[model samples]
Target: MKKEKIQLKGITWGHTRGFVPMVATAQRYEELHPEIEIVWKKRTLQEFADKSVTDLAMEYDLMVIDHPWTGHAAAQKMVIPFDDFLPETFLEDQRENSVGESYASYNFEGKQWALPIDAATPVAASRPDILQELDVLLPRTFDDLLALAQKGRVGFSLLPIDVLMSFYMFCCSSGEVPCQNDEQVVREETGVRVLKLFKSLADHIDERFYAKNPFKVFEDMTQHDEIAYCPFAYGYSNYSRQGYARKLLHFHDLVALKAGDEPMTSTLGGAGLAVSSQSKHIDVAVDYARFVASPEIQETLYVENGGQPGHLRAWKNTQVNALTANYFVNTLPALERAYLRPRYDGHLHFQDHAGDVVVHYLKNGGDERAVLAELNTMYRESLAWEGVHG
Candidate 1:
């Protein structure tokens, strides 16, 4: 009699960084365990961010997820908690070495809903050769960045989602964290100040960039000499790798709001690995998840195959830093201080619409107070949803 074969299907966002490593790891895992085979698929980035975990859980054995979805996943039991499946020591190591709040972001209601496999936050990127040719120093302050934008040398992602994340960055940098209260996203005064600051910068850039995302901004930077610097974008290590693009990008921590202040806090963005509760082969899925997230694998195979690793060891690996032109070394501080977004069951509802409100205020120059009021209404409604749904 022949032995039975186990097959597991996984879904991740479509990107070289997002999709490639899973395939690499799956291939490696299959070689290590001949009886088990893993197949991976991908969806668009927007779909990855907005799609419900419950829907994906029903079809796939493994899922690459946004941390914010953990709250909903836990609430709905869409994915099994790793605490019950993975070893305690492994979980402790993940917590200690997490990039910023990456590990904690996936823990909701006292359950470990997922294991962080990748980590990122917005960081500054520049074309060093272009800057040298233009004789421009990298912008060190908010005003310097504004002046560069005024010269049409700075490119940034201004999509509603990016704008909203920047809104959080400015609010937090200015000593007021947004969405801390049930009734408001931030204090009225802080919201107004952030909006004004954001608009002043946005006013200087080309209007066409309003539709671009971070990936597009990076592509524009490397493909043309027009963009000398990008003030901030969710850092992608691929651009820093040699031969990955036409021009190599030099990445670093964000510029200060002013000359003397500390660098700003960016909103955390990364993908987590979770096993579906509906999977037929739970043990094999858990074992595969561990293999992918283990420190040795994360630092070696994962990063080598186009991954931005969640493990701190990978971030500190000298060879890994060399491979990406010190991208990990330079941006790790920003990641360490990045703001972790809310993970309540209903926070996604607020996240989905709040960006549009910020984008409107940035483009239309409305009463900042009205913007705050609208955001507050959303916040209150989100909390009410938790009450009814939680």
Candidate 2:
């Protein structure tokens, strides 16, 4: 007697980079296993970041999730750890070849919660043709960025979440990391300086960007000609690929704070594949995740289909580089040094709300110290939920 076919469903964020590869891989997987079928659905990018994993797990067999939710996933057991199901040798290979901290970010409480299928960080992007036509060099320092913004040629995403990420970047660049202790996000001195620096550029850029995210900013840049340069946005390889957009964007490292300082450290932004604990077919889900995250698949089908692969093999693959105009190679350094966000159970509370506080200050020119105090309050509240909930 023949076995009955099994079906699985997965959820990923909406976007070619986030959605297409999963669909392609699922189709291929079904071809390889005639007894199985996989369907993929997508949510808005913001929803992908904000939705509760536990809720999603109830509906899907697989989830593409942000690393910051690992703590909650681990505490609630909403997703099973790959460590118990995947082979040690395979896990070891993932660790050895991880792009920066990509592999490590999903391991919480000593168990691998997810397999990083993509890796990204904010990197500089520009339309080389536009920059050349304008006879302006790409900005290399803070002052240079300000000068370029003054000319009304720079594009940046200032959405509340983006504002929070930028605040983290400025905090780190100013020689302090945010959310180090339970008491505060950062020292008042560093927080104040970072906000002031942020305000300087926020004051200059076009006001329309305050409502945009990286996707919209990239769309405006590629579809229209107004944005010649974006100093920092999550690097989207699709924008750089031939025929993927109306115009090609060349990506590069971020500008330094000073002429001699190191490139700015941006917040990490990527998605990982996790098996839902609620899945009826746990073994099948894990198998599919492993196949998707494998180097051979990631370097070839994944990248070719618009996915920004998390595997280092893909990052260094010549064919992958050729496909996306070396987008991986150009932005790898930023991913390597990217600051990992806090994942302690309730950190999402802060991630969700703190951005509003930062954005408000940037737009209203309020007291920086007061902003820091409010952020500290939020930080404490997030920490308070640490061990209390799933």
Candidate 3:
């Protein structure tokens, strides 16, 4: 009697640098479990944003979903909770800090919808040689970043969604809630200040220098050496693995507001694996999910393939440590402290509105008060939809 072959199909959004390691790991898993055939369907983040999971669920057995999508997916009953299928040992072996207990970013409504596949923290990537040529110290505050932008040598990238999230972090650090009182009063006081800061940076820097896509910023940093420093999402150890090797780009942990301001904070980002509720091959999918969470696979795939390990233990591997070096040492601690975005089903809609507000304020030079008022209205509508105030 021969064992039956299991074919697992998956869909992932975002073409971030993290994909390399995941694809590599899938190939390795195929070698080990010859009976398991894995097929991956890739989609741009925009394509995923344009469609709902319900429309695409039948195409893939496993989906690499965004953190914000979990609530919506769960509400639609599109994903299966892992508690019923995954073994206790599998959960026990996961990096304690990286799993549900410590990293609560991936959990919602007391159920774990997905296992974190990679970890990302926003950091500043700079051309060390350019900085040395300019003889400027690493920026330690948003004010310092503004100064760098003013020099007309260093550039800043403008990403609407990330900038809005970063504004949330800034406001929270300042002890102000952008969405306050169970989403009743949309407080734009803190939001306005954050946008003002961003506007100042934009005004000081050459508009031509702002890159819309982060990958373009990375490429410019490596190829043209034009940007001295720009805020970026971390976990690109794989990109640095080749070509320039050790000399290309340097990673700086996030910058705080000021010396006395709260510690710098960022949102937890990157993809995670979720089993589809509609899949008939639930057992095989669960096994594959467990295998993805294993330390051996995480270590080999994450480090060799350029994906950031969602397992804290894998982050401690000697090779990974050497590859990431101080970058991880300085950044992972921050990721541990990072906060998650709103976990409501309408998170995407809220993010879209917030992003539009940021972009509008930056481009049109409006009073932060008006923009924030509009943002608060949007948040209220989103909360109404989710039935969760605030």
Q: Is candidate 1 or candidate 3 better by TM-score?
A: 1
Model 2: per-residue lDDT, tens digit, 138-172? Answer: 88999998998898888889998888999999988
Q: What is the C-alpha lDDT profile of model 1 across 270-302, one tens digit per residue?
A: 899999999999999999999999999999999
Rank all candidate structures by their lDDT, best first, as comma-separated numbers: 2, 1, 3
lDDT of 3 at 26: 75
> What CA root-mean-square deviation does each model show from the true structure?
1.0, 1.0, 2.9
How do the residues 1-390 of candidate 3 rate in per-residue lDDT, one tens digit apiece? 998788888887546454555577678778988988888777875565446676666777888776777778778878888877777667655536482233455577877788887677666677778889999988888777878877765554466766676676666666664555655324556666767776777776555544445555566667775578876453355444446343466676677778766456765676678888888888878788778867777777656666666777766677776776455565666676566667678767777767767776787797778787777778778878787622
Model 2 poorest 10 in a row by lDDT:
381-390
Model 1: residues >4 Å from true position, as ranges? none
Q: Which structure is stronger by lDDT: 2 or 3?
A: 2
